[model samples]
Target: MLTRRTTHTTLALAASLSLAGALAGCAAEAEDSAATPPQPTTDASSSGAGDGSTDTLAGDAGTEYSDGTYTAEGSYQSPAGQENITLEVTLAGGTVTEVSLTSDATNPSSKQYQGQFISALEGAVVGKNLDEISIDKLAGSSLTSIGFTEALDSIKSEARA
Candidate 1:
């Protein structure tokens, strides 16, 4: 009787050990299933880097005209309406090399304002590469400044195409 009891106790212990090992294996598999999969990286070489020579015209205002020498266009409404800006962008080597600005409000009273706006735009984009030209809001003239920057962005898009 003592031998039989000892054998039964040993068999029970062995069974419990086997059950614990199986549970551990199942838990490990569950943990692996919960882990996130690796994400693929983007390849910049395959993506086309824009040459940045197209024109971006925003607002309900602004027009773009193309001449043989250069693209001539203006973005504006009436003098009393929303501000309009014209940007004459010169491109060479698939980049914006020069930017000229014109505005509809050019009277003696507002001439200085318009001139200052144009000067600010020209200064902002004169020698910068098309990819590097980004204009946030200008200090004094936000509207005209945004319009000018949009025009340059547009031009850069066209050049890329």
Candidate 2:
């Protein structure tokens, strides 16, 4: 048997408590969002929106590579035969410090051109930003350069922060 004033006070207290609980739940959610970094998405072209949409690749995020050796494989047909290319690159401070390539070409000419191509390609790619590596020419190894470029693409995808 509560009095009128007592009943009103109880109802007001219950309403205030419910509102506080709702606010506390919302605060927890806000903290969670603030604690987690947005994950980079596979689609490099999108602007990573805040609505949980796919984010841009890490290269565009202005983040450095986590400092490691990254490797990628690429294969393509050359004038001599099918060539499998393996690119092992060392990155530091987000720069390609070393580029090592091992190419297996079925064609005799490919074997002949491997060393020369490796030397030339290393000069072009080393000291370049990992994202902007484009092997446009390698003297006499045009077909092998194509394969190398493919490997570069793979490496970029792998090395994304």
The most accurate candidate by TM-score is 2
lDDT tens digits, residues 1-161, model 1? 56988999999999999999999999998888779576645444454555534333322123332321244343534344555566777765544567677766655534555577776776776665556666655546544555666666566445543
Candidate 2 lDDT over 1-161, as tens digits, reads 99999999999999999999999999999999999978844654455574555654444636456567988888777666677889899988778899899976656777777768887877788888776766656867677777787887777677666
- 48 Cα displacement, candidate 2 (Å): 5.4
Q: Which ten residues in a row have the lowest lDDT in candidate 1?
A: 60-69
Model 1: CA > 4 A from native: 1-80, 106-112
Error of 2 at 157 (Å): 1.2
Q: What is the lDDT of residue 52 in candidate 1?
A: 37
Pairs clashing within candidate 2: none
Q: Model 1: what TM-score?
A: 0.46
Every model's TM-score: 0.46, 0.60
